[model samples]
Target: MIHPPDRPTELGPGGDNAIAHAMGVAADEWTLLILRYALQDGVRRTAQWQQVLPISSAVLASRLRRMTELGLFSPVEDEEGAAYHLTPRGAALWPVLVCIWAWEARWAEGHPLCLPRMRHLVCGHQFEPCMACRTCGGLVEPREVTGSFGPSGSWPRSAPNTTMRRRSSGSANLGPGFFPESRALIGNRWSAAMLGAAYLGAHRFSEFQRRLGAPATVIADRLRTFRSLGVLEVLGDADRTDRHHYRLTDKGRAFFPVVMSAIEWGQRWFLAPEGPAVVFRHRGSDHPFSVLLLCSACSRPLTGKEMTVD
Candidate 1:
């Protein structure tokens, strides 16, 4: 059965605190913004969030409280008391956030929402984002994936030192996009759940929990992780005080291909006798459909050894 990483039933990352896991959802939008801001500005204060974010004091406090509680951020010693900085978990999200940002600039009609102009770090070219396999020159395809939880048990825990083992799927050779580290992140339960939830339109915490039945702490942590990584956004609600809403940023939305690939894999392996647990639809036609990750060069279904990473 598909289960989230094991957790203690407590309110933190220490033991079997399931509640701690549930609280991670709040980290989605609001918390991620805080982390992203910290990455850019070095540190940030509660007041900065109040002025720039549409979040209410209560919700902001709640989100920050949860992050501090999870050790994702800590107050640094400064003249102004302390500013929020990235913890180990928060730092790990950098690549994920970058990936999401690139996805947005490339796919989402080039929407400008809040994203800064694109910066291609590797090539130093000013352009939109795109993901390529490090090993192969080809693009990543959905069906070509095979993955595991990776070395880390969770954010607070240390990851083991070893090569990732690939799980077989369709007959086609997998593509290069399923790089060792990237696959591990994508295969994670929280990442998958958050991505799946976004595709299902569960933007807010309450709604995500309602739809997925995930604990509050778990949802909160994953959201924070994703946010820190830049997959989700937390916008302050002018009308609501105690609660804030979450949304997949353009980067997060572009991650739809990753989710589509997962859904496709589930359909192949985990489908119940009754029917598919979910189905994707077209907005204009209202027609349900599934997406395929095909090769940009040959337009063929890419998989296994046939694929390479850029």
Candidate 2:
């Protein structure tokens, strides 16, 4: 049986906060786009990425440099000039990408471009992806999973200081398969942190501010954005400011698989001396939560190489 920590563990600069570390590396819209193209379209050359993405050269270069430093992409010199390939670490993000696609396909409405159909090669069927617990080999749900923080959970130690690109007015031009809501929720570190806090039962406005140590204005802006996106709802006394309780909507809760996949990936790739910043356990099996992306059609575990976007 799993037990809660006796006291919050404090993480230093080199602390092991997998989720935050992962967010620092791949949570940006540009990074996500680059990974999506590389994984789905076999994009490698810098020129190829420029042609496919609406990003500027300077920003693209910056993203590539940072991603390479983060160990996601490896620079390769080929016969045809310079190119980038997903390192094993980068390629492991396939499940996180697939979960985003699956969520957007189900919840997002009236998108200008149709999302691609995912084909599971093993099952030979076009299907949706589902989250399953690797230990028991059973389907997992939001309610069945419990998350807790470790020493790396503190905002100061875990928050990524990378400068985020401000949301552009021309988001619609981001082409097909871009996850706007997911991007809003996860691309920004503060937004992702607050959402993670919410999942861990942080409800009041003060609670969010206290736990994240974020500026009140930024927290307020994110709360408003969450409400506008239908991911969170404000409940309780309308007139009383302190009584307002922020809660995740059903839509918000549905993002669990993406979060879990990211946490699992982070834990695997980014290690901290203090240990994992977050821990998730399966309530039904009382075992460590191990996320497995399974094909909705055949219920077989899906791997990066075995799935194709069509």
Residue ranges of candidate 2 with Cα displaced over 4 Å: 1-16, 163-167
**Model 2 Cα lDDT, one tens digit per residue, 197-241:** 888899999999999999999999999898998889999998986
TM-score of each candidate? 0.41, 0.89
Model 2, residue 19: what's the lDDT? Answer: 75
Taking the candidates one at a time, how many backbone clashes does each contain? 47, 2
Q: For all the candidates, what are their Cα RMSDs to the real structure? A: 17.0, 5.8
Q: Give one digit per residue, the lDDT tens place, for model 1 in 126-164.
A: 443233333343444322333222221222221112212
Question: Highest TM-score among the candidates is held by which one?
Answer: 2
TM-score of 1: 0.41
